[model samples]
Target: MNTVATPSEVTKGKHQIDLIDGSFTASEAQDLVVPMLTKKINFHQIKRMSLFEKNHKDTCAPDRDRILELEEAKATVEDIFLQAKIEGKKVKMHSTIHITLED
Candidate 1:
């Protein structure tokens, strides 16, 4: 039988299941310590962070370091777009401009 698991299950070595298939499960932080004591599994705190998290602590990075990350994201997007365009898929980016009136 297909079972659905919350992120906690994954970190805990429990049954495997896909959440995309329509199972609802939630994880709590309190459950983690039992596995830490008995399971001997190595787990990091990153799983606790939301998928959409953008940690801004990187401003401390040197000037060149940040630009390299920006450039890589740009290159990856450009490569995917070029392939999509060649495959006859429609790719469009919409933008809006805001105007400010003089006081």
Candidate 2:
């Protein structure tokens, strides 16, 4: 089968969001994963740049660090996709985003 991604609607006061849970072919997995990672990386990059512009220095260390981490994750994901593509395998992926209210 192809990729099936069913995103659940967020309920009131819900802390967890089900983003994707499905099986996907290698190409489908790459299509689904790469864009998400790219978007997240772009977000952090923009945030970091904005902070730097505002402060005239590298003020968003956390965002910078997160961008690096996401880049590494993207690389690892690419490797997994490459292996799956070579092996003619499908990948089962489940992703959830959790929101927390912190003091």
Candidate 3:
């Protein structure tokens, strides 16, 4: 396997992000936009990592009718990473991966 630079939050099952090799191609960067970030937050990061964004009660839709919006947002994030193949840029889990897991 290529030398992996996992992020602080990478774990075996807690979550996983299967991303494209952006370094291999730049056009693939467009694949990083998750649908939820665009439909809800109106912006999504171009990344290929299993990073989770806690949904703030305050930012939820004012309509208050879309209970699934959060999950959809998460799916969108997942889609962006998966389709883009943009795995975490650098190696992770080698440093303080659990230095603050309890915090």
How high is each candidate's TM-score?
0.29, 0.79, 0.22
Q: Top lDDT: which candidate number?
A: 2
The lDDT per prediction is 0.38, 0.87, 0.39
Please identify model 3 stretches exceeding 4 Å from their true place: 1-66, 86-103
Better of 1 and 3 by TM-score: 1
- Candidate 3 per-residue lDDT over residues 1-103, each given as its tens digit: 7567477534433533444332422233333334423554332221211123353333434333343565575675456545545554421211112222232
Best candidate, TM-score: 2
Off by over 4 Å in 2: 1-12, 100-103
Q: What's the true lDDT of residue 23 in model 3?
A: 48
lDDT of 1 by residue, 31-85 (tens): 3222332322111123223221565443423333444554555455556555655
User: How well is each residue in 1-103 modelled by candidate 2, as lDDT tens digits?
Assistant: 5454345433334476678899999899999999999999999999888888889856687998899999999999999999999999999999999985555
Model 3 local distance difference test score = 0.39
